[model samples]
Target: MTSNPPKNPLHSARLSFRAPESPSDDDFFSAMVSDIDAYMNSNITNATVPGSKQAKKYQEYLTEKTLLGVVICLRSTHVDGNESEKPTPIGAMHLCKSGDGMTHHRSTEIGIEILDGFQGKGYGSEALTWILEWAFRRLGLHRVQVRAFGWNVRAIELYKRLGFTEEGRWRDALWHDGQFWDDVQLSMLEDDWKQRAERNLDR
Candidate 1:
């Protein structure tokens, strides 16, 4: 008999998280690349700014990194049609370790992107919350950090609402559109997550 695939981690509502099993699954590669490009190019002051190299090579990069356990893939899913239907990928979140050995074991950086039509529907928040829980609880991490472009107000707001505190801003770190944008860093510590959990219990 064959073993079953791993079960997905369910979130508060519709979103679910799973590992990407294959690069050939249901337009996953193309869709993910498109989402990355769309996110990078959105709200730009100049139309000619190029997308990141990672966006161009996301398939090979994600596959290799994920297999090496340097990155945890959070494939966000949602059900459609009926309960018998398999959930579809709506977005992806990734938590990447900073380096090898015990020195970097307690810290990780997170990145998330939701498909264009799926933004602002609470999916991003749910996905982010689930990943943070996994990072701190399951992985026993001391801190989780994320960086967002300065002009991405919506993303910055979501990060703040989810208990990440502003660590610092790298002045004019990203050159895009006709001007440079600050790369804002935010982080949540293990203590911070515990406090947020307590507040939720109190609610």
Candidate 2:
């Protein structure tokens, strides 16, 4: 299997951030149209697929509210795992920033979704680590925030392990299987990440 380092996950390897291309009708219909339908029809709470209803609505709201046009970063991998050519997108990370010049102490929200069949692998953790590092370093942003349902222990643990602290808790936030669960709000600051990164580097 191909291997890459998780520490300081981003290296000289080429990954570019660009506006989500003007989606073709099929892309829009598939990602936005279909996702909306799924969200409305199903009781899923953490659906993150692009064409799902929840994703589409969130996209619309984010674009209108933030005006940062969804910035997406894609991965390129060689089919042979050796030769370098067109790289297939194995994952994506979505980002939006505050329009006002309020800087790090302002508001920005991030959403991350890995393609189906890619969960449980370390890819999500690596991607998040690199992106948060970039946001704190390149963007000069102070805070990065995300939300996940309480039942998603994997995600919750991942965020916590990355030094994200619980900022808010909404009890009985989601209803499913004849019961309700909490929705958690998590945030990390540049200071927090810097401290953690320094410790890791020292170790």
Candidate 3:
């Protein structure tokens, strides 16, 4: 709930997004991302063991999946009454392709995590918007998609607010916290993103 962003963070927004660059960054990610509570609504299936060499394993996973990862850090130019000399890693996001020849060139999926302390601080939405823009406009990607569990109402609504249209759902595909949950798929196509951009400009 406090502002402690470093000056000149990457990606040119309220926060920074870069690939993990050091041991400390990995440590921050391993510790913050290994929490059980954080995954309460997440659809990720692999749970890295705390205090393990998660970074290497994670990097391998990304390589195997051909995923591009970015670490989310505090980067602000606002007068939030605080500052940090070094960018603090608060969360991470990834862009992944399906690895199929048909879809690899045109589409990717996005996934993000906001540290527990940073939740509800408008960080997640901002990060997603930036990545979606980068995917469509910068990377020339045709489609960007995301998957959220039905039980995660916050995420479902956030994706909707960001112009992701519901594509379909895998009914009762996930079992977590003592019940079945639907895995909802949502996406934003290139034309859709362009249209949304025009609408925002007209606003």
Candidate 4:
């Protein structure tokens, strides 16, 4: 099982995060691939693969991206003398760095997609916080950015509540679901993530 941690979970309090353990891992396939509901509001305007060809599509995705992406999972319950049970996957997240060499050191964009069944249960928030910490401290990134559609007030509000600043809005940048919507850009600097309360952005 080749994975980021191999056997251990990533740094999340209520969930497990790790690289895909296998190409055929059923849990991963269901949560990240076949789960159309999870991607409903995500706006996959750049998707290159058809829904039915997910396995190959996923492998291509892995090969094409310059980033650290992880499968988010529910921590497995430990049983007597059986602590090796695998966690159940629930979603995916990533920190995609800039492809431009000049900008690689200081910034990355984050994306979080939770399963429809798993949304709004604090799991996303927990995962986001841990990733932000990793971005600033572990990756030494100067800024971590994220984007949401203007209509996705829930996601934007969550990002703000967690310390991201509204950076800009691209007017009618994305045409989705029959209407053009603004792409709302937001970001958090290293200092902002570290001194959120001091900046009054953590409210």
The lDDT per prediction is 0.67, 0.59, 0.75, 0.73
Give the poorly placed runs of model 1, Cα more than 4 Å off.
1-12, 41-56, 66-82, 102-105
lDDT of candidate 4 at residue 22, scale 0 to 100? 57
The sequence of per-residue lDDT tens digits that candidate 2 reaches over residues 1-203 is 97873533343244433334434222532443344332322224434443455445554543565424433334565765342553333344555656567553654666665544455767667767777877777767778888877667777898898889999889997875467878789999888989999999999
lDDT of each residue in 1-203, candidate 4, tens digit only = 76554433364655777775555554455446556645655645534333646645563554357467777777755554233566767777788857766665688899888877888898888899878877887788998899998768889999998989999999998776678889999999988887874565646
For model 4, the stretches where C-alpha displacement exceeds 4 angstroms are: 1-9, 46-50, 62-64, 78-84, 197-203
TM-score of 4: 0.80
Per-residue lDDT of 1-203 in model 1, one digit per residue for the tens?
A: 99965554543456656655553443664565556454583323224433444443554444456312212233334464234446666666677745566445578888776777677778788877888888887878898888888878888899999999999999997787678889899999999999999999999
State the displacement of the C-alpha of residue 195, model 1, in Å, after optimal TM-score superposition.
0.7
lDDT, candidate 3, 1-203, per-residue tens:
99955644345456877776655556765765466556455535633344456555554444446557787888644375334456677877888866657665688888777777888988999998888878887778998889998888999999999999999999998877678879999999999999998999999
> Candidate 3: how large is its RMSD?
5.6
Which is the better candidate, 1 or 2, if ranked by lDDT? 1
Clash pairs of candidate 1? none
Error of 4 at 4 (Å): 24
By lDDT, rank the candidates, best first. 3, 4, 1, 2
